[model samples]
Target: MSKTITNIHTIDLVSDFKEITKMRLAVSVVFSSVAGYFLGAEIIDFVEVLLLAVGGYMMVGASNAFNQVIEKDLDALMNRTKNRPIPSGRMSVNKALLIGSTLGALGLIILYYINPITSMFGAISIFLYVSVYTPLKTKTPLSVFVGAFPGAIPFMLGWVAATGSFSIEAGTLFMIQFFWQFPHFWALGWWLYDDYKRGGFFMLPTGKRDKGTAVQIILYTIWTIAVSLIPVFGVTGRLYLTPVSGVLILILGLGMLYYAYKLYQSRDEISAKKLMFASVSYITLLQIIYVLDKYIRIWI
Candidate 1:
């Protein structure tokens, strides 16, 4: 009976840890970082790539754990986040702080071993996400803009990790993801507006689900599309998209734009949800296309 109880407790602890760190989101961020690394690496080093993945995940996880600690009360107020580890009392604050601090330090140290610039950006992402963006959510809608800085870093961080320098190509990747967030998160803000309101987070530009917010979403979607296509035009160094990849990307962007347009027209939850999914698909597909295109260029 004692051994069985101990096993159950261990399982529960594992689950709580996963909830605190937001494992899936952390992994996705690592994925983007890896994609960026692949794009920038002239000669791929598998060991460094593995280190990058682990380090990126640790940094992102630290940010998330800290964010939850900071927003425990606010999280409890929201339906979507009410059951998270800290909010639900599954994990204590002190343990979470230790986890976050340790992970953050470990992550930065590993990244620094790879390169200083990569470590610097990694630190910036954590600070901006936890110190700036986390607090700004309750104070003003402009938090999204502040948040975009950190949110866009993982993609560029990967590139910097591989190259040990920041370049226009890295900047372009950052800009594409940066602009993409407005529509992606706005749609989410729209879909979860009520939940956010419950948590006192104002995520929309207009602070309401009106034509103003919808219009902004549409406009940013357009901006995202434009920025994504720039490299194909030879504007971004070390990056080029073939006509086939460009067309595919255009179709994907247009598909997302269509949903954004529908959200504007209907101003309804369903359309917002559709736009949210479309945005996710767009980013994932775009990243894949960009990575595939780079390798294709090498072969051709």
Candidate 2:
């Protein structure tokens, strides 16, 4: 009976860890970094990629854990987040903080082994997410703008990890992801506006569902599509995309834009939800397309 009880306790602890760290989100962030690493690497190093994935996941996990610790009370007020480890009383704040700090330190140390620049960016991402964006969420709608900086870093962080330096290629990757976040997050904000309000989060640009917010989402969606195509023009250095790849990307962007337009026309929760899912699919597919196009071009 004692052994069975111990096994159940272990499983619960693992579940709590996953909840606090937001495992799926962390893995997605790691995926972006890996995608960037592949794009930047001339000769793939599986070991290095492995290190990048683990370090990136740790950094993202740490950021999430710290975020939950800081927003425990606020999270409790929102139905979507109320059941999270910290807010649900499945984990204590002190324990979460300790895990966050440990993961953060270990992540940075691993990144440092990759390169100082990579480590520096990891630290910057954590600081912006935990210190700046987290606090600004309740204060202003611009918090999304602030949060985008950290959110976009993962893709470029992978490039730096591979190249051990910064360049236009890395910057272009950063810009693409940075602009992409505006539309993606705004769609989510629109869909969750009421829930976010309960937590005092001003996520929407206009702080409510209105023509103004929809218009901005449309505008940013256009900008994201434009920035994504910049590589096709051959100006982004090593990040140039072929015309064929560019056309494919354009089509994907148009699909997302179609949903963005639908949201504008309908201005309803269903439309917002559609836009949110479209944006997620758009970015994920875009990254995959970019990586696939690069390899195909190389093969040809």
Candidate 3:
């Protein structure tokens, strides 16, 4: 009976540690990146796919862990993040830093197993994300642009991991994700502008949810939808999107734009929150659809 109780306590402690590691978010990003790789590959390489999954998970995990480490104080101030392991005293800074560095090193090593270029990119991503993007979040809204560089890499990372080189297809993938991030993140900024301000993070452009910021959100959303359909018109070359896929992409984009437009019209926090949620769903579903469109191997 005592041993059973002890085991339960141990499991709970491990769970707390994982919460700090941001494993769930990392897993989602890894899934999307691997799906991109499989879809983009001329011939799927399981080894490269495996390395991507592992490497991507490690890198993202490291980023989140270090983020928690940096924001421990600010995290303690906010309702949404106050109970995270570092801020809640469930884990110490030293422990988190050690694990983050170890995981980051291991992630790069795994990428190197695929190729040196991949390993180099993985290292650069970690440096930019943890070192630059993290600190800049409190300093300027431009952090969004800086962070976008790392955020956009997963899609093209798939292409690189597959082809051992970058090309038009990779560039197209990068551009699609790059444009999609602005509206997605800006919507989040809209909703969290207050909390972010309290934490000294100038997340929203113009520092307000006014017409100018809304206009930018709506414009970027339009571009996101347009780019998602580029492959259908032979504009993306090797990244062809069929007529049916194009229709679905159009529907997804319109659905997302509807929410963005609504938020723009209202400038209400609740509306911004709705748009933010919709953006998450949009990116996730769009990636799933793209992979499935290819998986079924139908022209449509």
lDDT scores for all predictions?
0.94, 0.93, 0.84
Which rank order by lDDT, best down to worst? 1, 2, 3
**Candidate 2 backbone collisions, by pair:** none
- Clashing pairs for model 3 are none
For model 2, the stretches where C-alpha displacement exceeds 4 angstroms are none
For candidate 2, the 10 contiguous residues with the lowest summed lDDT are 278-287
Candidates ranked by TM-score: 2, 1, 3
Better of 1 and 3 by TM-score: 1
Highest-lDDT candidate: 1
* Candidate 3 wrongly placed segments (more than 4 Å): 298-300
List, residue by residue over 126-151, the lDDT tens digit for candidate 1: 99999999999999999999999999
* Model 3 Cα lDDT, one tens digit per residue, 168-200: 888888888888889988988888887777777
Those runs of model 1 whose alpha carbons end farther than 4 Å from true positions after fitting are none
Better of 1 and 2 by lDDT: 1
